[model samples]
Target: MLVRLVYASRASRELSPQDLQDILRRSRDHNPAEGITGLLWYNDGVFIQVLEGGRDPVNARYKRIVMDNRHDAPILLTYQEISERRYAGWSMGQVNLHRLNPGLLLKYGETQKLDPYRMSGAMLTALFDELVSSGAIECA
Candidate 1:
């Protein structure tokens, strides 16, 4: 089954431009080999990411992410098992930080601070469309 996890974290002020670049590079490199795919969005002081893939690989990646010293402990905002792959067209996808906004964030339930499971398919589609349009994430 394909699994999707949406998460957010507070970025540290110490994070430098080079550091962010490195993290993005590493994420791109890691995803494809592990059979993982997703988009990462950053704004304000938060890093929000959506990961989708096999259960084992996805879980393992999440473990590594939580242990990584670069990012703070991420809060798992939502999780869902989907019948289809939303980002199958991309390998190790990414979304740039500049494209993030309140509307985009709301797609992930930021405005209401609610769970994604409660969201409708239209809402999810809107969120995915925004990510695709942003053209933020790059494949390694």
Candidate 2:
């Protein structure tokens, strides 16, 4: 069965554009071989990421992420078995939320700011759904 895991993290320091590009490059390169597909959004020093694949591998990836030094305080927002992938085409879709919309943010347990650590699991999922539907994010 496929599994989905969502989590949020704070960057240890401000990241340059090159740093973000490297992360996306690595994600795109590695995810496909492991059957993982998901979305990642980074803004205001926070990162919101979802990973979907076999339960074991997905969990394993999350473990590695927890140990990664680029980020701090990784908090899991959700995890579950899924009937289908919400992100199937892109290995790692990227969202741009630097200029957030308050109305949409409120719909997903968010304020005018982007703070995934403060959201509930269900709300995080709903926010991801919104990201997909509105093309707020796109594939790298």
Candidate 3:
């Protein structure tokens, strides 16, 4: 089954160019090797990512992410199983960085305050669009 997860974590520090480079390198190495795919969005001192793949691989990656020192206490904002792949061709996936502002996010109907699982795909898509328009992410 294809599974999708949306999660957020607090960064240990403001992301530097080198930090971004390292993440890009690691993501490129991990995605194809593990059959993982997803999108990552950095904003407001938080790293929000969406990962999809087989249950085992995805879960394993999530476990490792939870333990990684780069982030602190990863929070699973959303998780679900889907019949279709939203991001199928992505290798280590796409990374988009956005300037974090609560007010800007709130324009999307309390996104920062709401539970991720409670959001519908349309809502998620809306947020994704906003991020893209704001230059927070680039499509793969």
TM-score of each: 0.72, 0.93, 0.74
Task: Name the top lDDT candidate.
Answer: 2
The digit string of per-residue lDDT tens for model 1 on 62-136 reads 887788665675777667888887777665566654545556656566583423445544455467667687774
lDDT of 3 by residue, 79-138 (tens): 788888666666544544345455655766655653344555556656765654565555
For each candidate in the order shown, give its overall lDDT on alpha carbons.
0.68, 0.86, 0.70
Ranking by TM-score: 2, 3, 1
Residue-wise lDDT of candidate 2 within 1-140, one digit each (tens)? Answer: 89999999999999998999899999999999999999888887898899999998899999999999997999998999999998898899998664345678877664667578678878878877887787677775
CA lDDT for candidate 2: 0.86
Off by over 4 Å in 1: 97-126, 133-140
Of the candidates numbered 1 and 2, which has the greater TM-score value? 2
Task: Evaluate model 1: give its lDDT.
Answer: 0.68
RMSD of each: 4.3, 1.5, 4.1
Q: Write down the TM-score for model 2.
A: 0.93
Regions of model 2 farther than 4 Å from truth: 98-100
